[model samples]
Target chain A: MALKFKTPMLDELEKGPWPSFVTDVKRMAARKPACEDWLGLMEMSYEHKEGHWKHGGIVGVFGYGGGVIGRYCDRPDLFPNVAHFHTMRVNQPASKFYNTDVLRKLCDMWDRRGSGLTNMHGSTGDIILLGTTTDQLEPVFYELTHDFGMDLGGSGSNLRTPEGCVGMARCEWSCIDTQALIYDLTMEYQDALHRPMFPYKFKFKASGCACDCVAAIARADCSIIGTWRDNIRIDQEAVRAYANGELVPQAGAHGSEKYKLDIKAEVVDLCPTRCMEWDGKNLKIWDEDCTRCMHCIRVMPRALRPGLDTGATILVGAKAPILEGAQLSSVVIPFMKMEPPYEEFKGFVEKMWDLWMEEGKNRERLGELIQRMGLREFLKACELTPDPRMVNTPRFNPYIFYDPAEVPGGWERDLKDFRSRHQA
Target chain B: MSEEAKARIIEWVKQQKKTKHYFNDLCKAVPEIKMMQAKKIINELVNEGRLKYWSSGSTTMYMLPGQDDVAKEEKGMN
Candidate 1:
């Protein structure tokens, strides 16, 4: 494609080994004037060693307080075409499965009213339509909602879009319906998603199993990872097949290994709890010792299956660094039935939101809030019972702080008695 | 119920004698109302131009219309 603008700095990015966003933007620039102006601005940024963008302005469709992020080029005279290049976040469908017809219509709408550039899926699982004027915000939103039957995702101090891995839809290892779980939550929290109600942004991510293909545990405020309480179901014949090399180990996921398979060395020894043993003819599993980490099951998928009774483990308060350091979600509910409507889960979410909205400081993430007030306090606030499974390891130190109400006589008479016994 | 919640929130904000307030402050004002319910009312108020949003880039707060001077005065006094 011929260059519309001189983006020397951006051209340099196209030479990288990795796929470049600059190259992608240049492709969009051929059609979108906004994209061309954006490229110019970006090149100017790289040359001047500073960005020419300012954010935060009151711009959104009617009634919605979020989802439209207001951005403006500081040097508007230089790049008037992208002076008001706001970003709109369209809420994506569960697991981001999109048909071609709807995608083409969405593209047509963008081409008519705004920049054709898109993020496809943002970190929070929103379809981010980048670079549009303020005048097009309403029409774009109108087309998106009325024509496409899709609404905007969240922004600011709102409940961000809930996302999940492709659950029972595609994968065999899916223990719970992650797609259903996320969709139900998204529908139920429509008001929260559109309104800036929380002290800060909250995210929900669901993974079908503990493999955590969605990286839910590391990023979500609410991490729902599937699990089971019963034993790993085993097929001796399939096990024998895998042992004899009739079946590939890990279903050939490792890809083109030169060495032959050794069931004992690869599967049995690698089991975190040492629950599995292979004596060449038979395989023995001590189910109680298994942690349901999905290692052995993943290794020998044809042989081992998740237990009949399957659910999800709920963890809370994970976030990337801001006030405090980055945190992975900790187990709050070890396991819960993740059926439709999910009343129990919704109640839990409401309780957490209520406490956070009332007590959390502005810009404080849920994890940072949990850290600010001790985990014990958070548990008590949410009415969650203290469980041993919640912690990776119990507190090593014995410096537990007990409330005065928890003691028999309180801490009143002890002070007077101590003064009388010792020198005042 | 939303009307009542909105009235209570507005009264609470007036009582505070401040221009800007957190969404938490509104939630605190109407403790009986659920967070989602309060959010609906607040959103309605903002949309109707009775209330406005004040942003500090990192945080978003609610304020009464034309209350910039009032907030500045309050900050000065504090």
Candidate 2:
């Protein structure tokens, strides 16, 4: 078939650079000459007085496959097999295990029912299936839910998929098991994920510790971070060995230097419980006052370490309103036990969702609603006590009392100085 | 000049004299006319001493060569 190139509408870049759908379509044309017909349709759509794709058409893959978005071609006769589809992104298990048979089944189903073009993951964090008709949507959804034992994530203003970092199973940094937490939260909040009730979208993320591999601080409304209530366990002999190069540092030279110093000063001076003391030759930790900040453990991996006690710190209101761009989630429930079938964690999530949905205005995210109504009121509504650890002191606290006479000259001079200093 | 070119110039002159329109606005008004074609017609009118034009950024607006008096009269009426 002759190459039929379609001219796209030249508009502002909606998203950042990283080759878009247009670029992908062009690449397809280069490989398969028959794909040119699809490109031609795209170009002609731009030329039309109205829009390109006709609204209200059924296009998707199989009976039950989400994580993929599908758009139908208005003129299917002109370009056969030109159907739109996107992928879904499920949070990968900490062990990174995927049943090969299950994956093969999904791929085979896609090939049989829809387009062979499969994206490993979709933007919204789901395994994406591309291209299907309207009739296929219900059946595919059912098959995915019933047969595949999978569920759809984030359709409207609802709880999105819960993501987590690889926890104690694989990573050494992990203080708690994040994988179990993510799975438990998802299973418990299955109803919340499927049903839409909120004024805006909600997201959840769990990290093993403050290392924050999942980027939970920026993305999730409710962030569960692992931590310990105990102190650091220090061994003076190991520290001396590390300092003398007898033991190489896990994090390298900087870590070795840090370990040497902890042995010399912080372990002796800053240790609140006198857990660490130098007995002329070696250092010793009392073990009782070793609050696991991971500072000592991170510095001297071989010499010092964390205790067995592990729990999670919950944070709330970590998203921005749609109108005002992005915001960080704040620490709300400072510490909570994260066991299997996490009832306490689940209760907290439900309370927060209820408060946000009931009080939040249209387009207002959880963080924004809290900002407008004040955290005190929000906590009161949720029936949650004020946890000092959860309170985030605003970076720009505009609560200073302005004494008009304090300035050297006057307020005008201060204003002028401020303006001049900030003038670009 | 050909009669067709003269007629085109006259039409452009009428459009320019009507206040508040730029080259791009003219192109939009006549969807069939390309931007370059509109600019050319505008330039031809100015060359023939039928219209005058001024620019603000990329937006070039036109007016009948000696319409200041007409503008003043309209301002007075308002």
List candidate 2 segments past 4 Å from native.
Answer: A1-80, A83-96, A122-124, A246-300, A391-424, B1-78
For all predictions in the order shown, the interface RMSD in Å is 3.9, 25.1
For TM-score, the strongest prediction is 1
lDDT of 2 at A387: 52
Q: Candidate 2 residues A25-89, lDDT tens each? A: 45556644334555666567666765445322112222211223334455656765453322333
Task: Please name the candidate that would achieve the greatest DockQ relative to the true structure.
Answer: 1
* lDDT for each candidate structure: 0.84, 0.57
Residues forming the 10-long window of minimal summed lDDT in candidate 2 chain A: A56-65
lDDT of 1 by residue, A184-210 (tens): 999998887887888888899999999
